[model samples]
Target: MKPGIRPAHRPVVFRDKAADLASPTRSTMTGDRTVTWEDGTTYPMADVEISSASHPFHTGTARVLDTVGRVERFERRYGRGEAR
Candidate 1:
């Protein structure tokens, strides 16, 4: 815990453009740009390509379908038998 040796943790606004979500958190990252948040307060903002709001794993929006179930459905529709 050396004084002035560690990076400073300050308020940062992480913006997820794809999800249109912005949240405030403390980080060592700094930004020259600022943005007015929903509360009408401006903070050092950083643009993120992906965040929990837009991330498939976090949002549970990942396209994960059951391939076996799909094949079964298709076979049932066309009659399950030897392929011709």
Candidate 2:
């Protein structure tokens, strides 16, 4: 990709419908859906399933699985915990 010959960067908003979040940025993605921003300008909207707003890592809502329990269960069935 050439530096100056790249695709045009236009104002866009990647919207996460599930999280009801919209991030305004510049991108080359175009969509049929248009949205009115706070500035009263309409921009292209790209609907996404997940974003930083709703992601477990960013939102700090991730589930912590119990790996210790699984390990104990495996050792009980295979008799491997004593080898260490």
Clash count for each candidate, listed in order shown: 0, 0
Candidate 2 at residue 72, lDDT? Answer: 94
Model 1, 7-64: lDDT tens per residue? 8898899989999888999999999899887788889999999998999998887888
RMSD, every candidate, angstroms: 6.7, 2.9
TM-score for each model: 0.66, 0.77
Error of 1 at 13 (Å): 0.5
Cα deviation of 68 in candidate 2 (Å)? 1.3
Best model per TM-score: 2
lDDT of 2 by residue, 9-48 (tens): 8999899987998989999999999999989999999999
**Alpha-carbon local distance difference test for all models:** 0.90, 0.91
Clashing pairs in 1: none
Window of ten residues with lowest summed lDDT in model 1: 1-10
